[model samples]
Target chain A: MVFLSFVNCMRVKGPDKFWKRRQILKLAAHFYGRKRNCYSIAIRSVQKALQHAAYGRKVKKLERINLWKERITAACEELNIPYPLLMENLARCDIALSKKTLADLAIWEPRTFKCLTQIAAAKNQSYPPTVKAALQPPPEGVITRGML
Target chain B: MNRPISTYKRVQQWAVFGRLWFLFDAKWQNPFDSAEKIAKYLAGKHKPIYHPLSDVGDHVVVINTKDIALPNKEWRYRMYYHHTGFAGGSSWTSAWELHNKDQTKVLWKAVYKACGGSLLRHNMMERLHLFPDDKIPQELMENISDHMKQLRPVPKALHEYTEEEIKNFPKVFEWPEDYVLN
Candidate 1:
């Protein structure tokens, strides 16, 4: 229907109120008791639930990253390397492995991870004194431009 | 097609998660450092599929515990504390004294500590087989398919070098023939 005047248009609402409440109720379908059926309660719970859902998505990613770091740290410790040093040196060496992939290799492809650690270790000498004391001298063939 | 794919996946799971038996030679190795490495294998940390919740740890057979070397004076300074739970039952035993009482106890304790105080510690410890000498039971020996490398190379004692090897070693200069005896 067309509005006859500006006053008539001002008095009109955009859509039927039923559809809007139905949207919120549909989201609250799994909510408990009155929250699932009553519009007033359902809308509140639905908004809260949606907020939690959004926050949870971000937290889930952060938790996974923390877990990957934990796994990588454990694996690096086994090779007598620090976790930060391994990550920093890996970047310095231009080996662009993500924490998830690095953690995966540490578990399933341990030999490959060990080789990566050796490459990182070879890049630094006399620094990270623990590496010097713990690891044997880097094999003869490894070459790097020192601290360019 | 589904049946074949499912069967292949099943076999792949087994291959990826199969448990392994590892041999560790503790001869001339520092027990503390060796324990850290041994604990990794025992807890299945060396496996890419390792998860704290998963029961994927492997068996470890450690031999020659009697020869484990303690750095510095740890053998004398280190103490093993024990408590019998009775009044005045607590006692501290020096590392050397404990080693004398039981050759395997030192390395055993080292590994136990290295494995951490997790709930699975006992389960992991159960899989550890310790022998004072290199003599492992035939049953255990048959299962060892891999060896854990020692943390440090075993240093060769002067006496261990063959006369030919010692003679062939390069010297800056031969001791002067006229050098007087001490």
Candidate 2:
């Protein structure tokens, strides 16, 4: 019974160390409470489950930021506003939000974020202006545009 | 009272009502310009008995905050953040919203809110003085701003080290070749 001996050897490695044991115990814990009398068997089978939970924390920060960027980018795309154009428009309007903060707010505060989307939508419907018109102050001799 | 953790500067938290009640007020000083001045007064550093590392100060109260200035452009540009604690629940309002809503509450709210209403904070807040008006009696503030502006004489040099010799010093430790035998 080489397999039985191998299983015994794995049990000595503990529930947090053996790969097969780890997976089985995690699956068991996910689907069934580990309180069953036979759960010790599951624990033996999934020896490294706890280890996986503890040691599997190496997600790259840049990759996470990129993922967030993609989410915001997709959301902006749906509003028909390219990211650069939207950013430029916001800057022109003097919005001082950072990209990371906006991305986080986009994820965490969706309804509030929709207000920004509404602003973008309004911009899309507005009349086209002379390129860089937003960059300049009103002419000295002429009244400011949008003067009522 | 529990002893302070640091060797220098003792601080004790005090129990008090949340609203800043004035003993009296002097002329309302522009707080933003006088933030340093007011902090020194409240912190008790304006006294001749002041020690650099000691916490020997009286509390300060401020009122009539409606006149404080923020950089004018910031009113339109800056955003204050808040959360509703649900997915997609983040929100921000403009500085204009903050100013319009309760400008007087801004600094006081920010200070106490940051301190977060713990027992320790309640005690420390006893030292704060905020007045909402410029009419606080002159005796209450007592030349604090002017006194804070008075400069102390420059201290004599301590002469710890010369800068020129510091550059020639070796930066790293060298291991001995016979470490195992030693």
Candidate 3:
């Protein structure tokens, strides 16, 4: 059956659909011995394999942010603090932590993240009684600050 | 301890690049223990060539922005701000926001704030680069070989992590866990 397709099939899936020619050659080299069939059915097969690898990278990128979010949420949850609270305190303190960096710490350096939570908690606790209201100050405050 | 600013032959050009070194003080304490020390260390002022008015500063690069340590309660209280020219435009951003929002700018602000804001300071800052984490683009690495005398080998773990490792770490989910649960 495979032999019949090779002989009779008019459909010659152009290499362009697979990838750039250079990439196709790389795939071909990895799959079959580098020199034997530089361009053939074997090369096409290798291109398919290469396409799969590319997909794996794409999938990983899509999920990277999600994983970081999970790590941060986990760290926050364990500390009895929600992610939003931790973020708010940091913002209130003018502590700049990139999401990428925070996500990284939340995973690989939990100790550091715990310290961050402690800091935020301390900041929150140190606040005067009208704390929750301060997060989003009244329109009056906004007017005074913005227009008045 | 003053030394003339050293120059290395330029091998490549880059719009951005950063370098970090793990260093210990004479007493063996982490020199990076305080932001002041870190500011001094990166400023190259410890060297004899350190001059206040001259552009003798090295184009220091810093990685691991997140791993940087702070003394006592500094992290909790440090507030960053932005000006909008209007009276109410003075909005405060935190160190965390600066670090997380666009960390490169945070490093820029930190360095500028440390160096005593001046026109010359901007020139010095143009050379300093910071990444949120330790990763640098491959193209930047190619240019660095031209100007640097000593180059640190990129860590092996960084190569393996490639945004893929984040997915593999063990995960456990449980309900009834907290204040806000959906």
lDDT of 2 by residue, A107-133 (tens): 567565556655543443342354554
- Looking at model 3, residue B111 earns an lDDT score of 58
Candidate 1's C-alpha runs over 4 A off are A1-63, A70-86, A89-97, A101-148, B1-7
Q: Per-residue lDDT of B37-137 in model 3, one digit per residue for the tens?
A: 44553554533223345344454555555554444554566777779999889988776666567745544565567766566666666655566576767
Top-scoring candidate (lDDT): 1
Docking quality class, candidate 1: incorrect
State the local distance difference test value for candidate 2.
0.51
What RMSD does each model have against the real structure?
A: 7.7, 28.8, 26.8
The candidate maximizing DockQ is: 1
CA lDDT, candidate 3, residue B152: 26
* Candidate 1's DockQ: 0.23
- lDDT per residue (tens digit) for residues B1-182 in model 1: 44555888789888768888999999999999999888888898775566778888999999999999999999999999999999999999999999999999999999999999899999999999999999999999899999988888888899999999999999998778999869
TM-score of 3: 0.32
Question: Which residue pairs come into collision in candidate 1?
Answer: A107-B47, A107-B48, A108-B48
Worst 10-residue lDDT window for candidate 2 chain B reads B12-21
Ten-residue region with minimum lDDT total, candidate 1 chain A? A124-133
CAPRI-style grade of the A/B interface in model 3 = incorrect
* Per-model lDDT: 0.86, 0.51, 0.55
DockQ of each: 0.23, 0.01, 0.01
